[model samples]
Target: MVDKDATAAVSRSEEGDFVKSTWEVTVTSPEGVRHFPVYRTILKVPPVVLRLVQGELHFESALEVLHRREPVASGVLAVGETLRCGDWELSLHDRSGKSRAVLECFTDPFYSRIWTLHEQVTRVGRPGKRENELEIDHPTMSREHAVLSWEERGPVLRSSGRTWVDGVAAAETVLADGALVQMGDLLFQFRLLSELVLARGGLCVTSLGSFQARVHGELVTEKAWRTQAVRWMLARLALEWGRPVAVERLLDEFWPEMPEDKSRNNFNYTISTLRQVLGGSEAILRATGSLQLSPSFLGSHDLVALQRTLRVEDWGAAVELYGEYLPGCYLDWAVAMRGSLEQQVLQGGLRLLERYEASECWPEVLELGGKLHAIDSTCQRTALGVLRAHLGRGNASEGVRFYERFREHLGVELAMEPSAELAALAEQARGG
Candidate 1:
């Protein structure tokens, strides 16, 4: 009876606690955008959110986060709206938004984030006592170092002082996707966003596994090509997609064994046939004694995608693009191209394997290692990688089987035994 007030206060404290709930937030950085789960508490801001916005994360800086168009802490979570903090932009969304978000994340770098012309011209350099869009804290940077502006071609970097584009000194240069720009001591990678909607659609040239062309997803058959000369000519042009091919080079490459006059006649006929096959004369551009596949018609090619993936170190995509390299095409030029592509595949695979192993991703290591070994059984590193992945996953029997098969294959194919390191791994798997 005497402590009635104290007892009521304790009871209210226990019953009035706030319930926490989890929500999905999409984080966008310079590298890409990814989603993260965040918790809501009635009493205070979430610690994780605070840390992310405070620039404690390894991959992002505050400028990238705050620069995102979507405001981060808008109280109500809108499905498509973005919220920014330090280096992360948290966009609220449901399950259906995942795929769209990922696609946006991939295409946005080239379409949305960098290309949204209305976002105003931004400056990059040392953050003065005040705020800036792209704050580079290095001493070499001035407070207002450079201005990034949207131009007719794309984004152009106008340097306030010393600046370099792709290692060349330039006061201003139009930027392309994947162009490296250096200002002061800090280096920035420029990604150009797509401006045009591609009304004419694009071409897909399948040169790796087979020779075929798909115009706007409709396959153009070999019969439609009319002749082998036309097919070869199309493949050659497709191989050197954006670059101009000299008429002389085309004659030599397409009909090298034929005489000059006959080759010239064949080249003209093949060009005419190809134009008909492509269904438009504008599909190929001729100017100043050089020919190139038109930018309007040439949209996406497998070889171009493969090279881009490799350049970006997207190893899994690179492996997928490296199908049967120019299979069934016995032309000397095709054979040479095939060899070059195969070498790139092997080298790219090895690099991928190294990265997977470093990250302790045993499953990916096994999968990529098996693929590499299938391509070239003589690859001792790939064989070892597969064996290690099996053992790492606690499948000793599978490791033993893989080693035995690899050893047998090596002996049969190259008349060689397993290397000492690989032999020791086999012994370890066998509990020797």
Candidate 2:
């Protein structure tokens, strides 16, 4: 029997096979959060089929599962792109305006398959007992219909039978990054790893400062969001970025107090609104029982970009990018990420400040030191660095003034004085 007041939730497990997935079932109540693992065949069970039966979850296989497959690129995907093996017609495009291809069959919309083209030469044709790079079982497809090859220009398609690129019949066409190719009656999207990276005009998430989402460099204002839930939903999705977040987890997080059925409905509604705000369904990538932001659409994210910039020793640019993560977002997940990012920048700034001071780059040192001090006012090293920077720049009076404020701050905040080393630096500033 189940507790009448308890709410049941399902979270995805890290491990799963093609046919079976282990889901962690959490039941939350006044007693506390208790749970168990439930196993379901991925092919047979959809996340929607779980229901409460006599106080426990009854997992029944749906009559027909929309057997979707998302195929990810075999090679390193572009910076903002995440390709998964799944059946989705992601209307992602490169700068040239050609749709980025994720191969899929149009006949069965519910049972579509997506494949990543990784090979130099890929043969496409009708399915047989023999294996081919891509196989279409349609009657219009020949045994060997078309061949795709990576060339100096890009992915080029050559057809032995009737084929079309972007609806026009063609013998050969250089696939524009993401081009829809029709071989006989079967249509497939063709793409290359190189093209996805080079593709331009995608989403840019700026969370390090004010929370802003820009699609193709155009800002998505607060008024654009239909609801606060929809806005936060995008924030959560963008925060996870490349990682696929479980749908069940989202339902629990977003509306734990609401009934399970109501939460699911709301979740679906939120996704619909988010899709509209993001431009299309392709902006959100769907995997098996999970969702992720489309990598192709995510052209630039300040948090991700800032880390990359820091890695390349672009300290100034990194500092410029650093801001409170999701400024007004007080959600638990947002707060946690904000703390981690703040620490990362604080540590990086300290290192850069040391390097600048060693090179006698006082202006850079002062800029970095002030930022680091703001992030961690209690740090004696930062205070000392700031003083030295001012002294180095021949601004002795300013250094003394800053030291006096720092001393007072330490006394009031911690009931302590500046460290001996920091005090000595302050003395030098005072003497000058």
Q: All models: lDDT?
A: 0.61, 0.62
Per-residue CA lDDT of model 1 for 303-370, tens digit only, reads 87676555545566678778766677778888898888777888888988988888889999998987
Q: Estimate each model's TM-score.
A: 0.56, 0.56
Clashing residue pairs, backbone N/CA/C < 3 A, model 1: 62-86, 70-82, 71-83, 72-83, 72-84, 110-193
Model 2 lDDT per residue over 288-332, tens place: 478876544555666776665455445555676788888877777
Q: What is the C-alpha RMSD of each candidate to the true structure, in Å?
A: 16.1, 20.7
Candidate 2: lDDT of 355? 81
* Model 2: residues with Cα > 4 Å off, grouped in runs: 1-176, 179-199, 256-259, 411-416
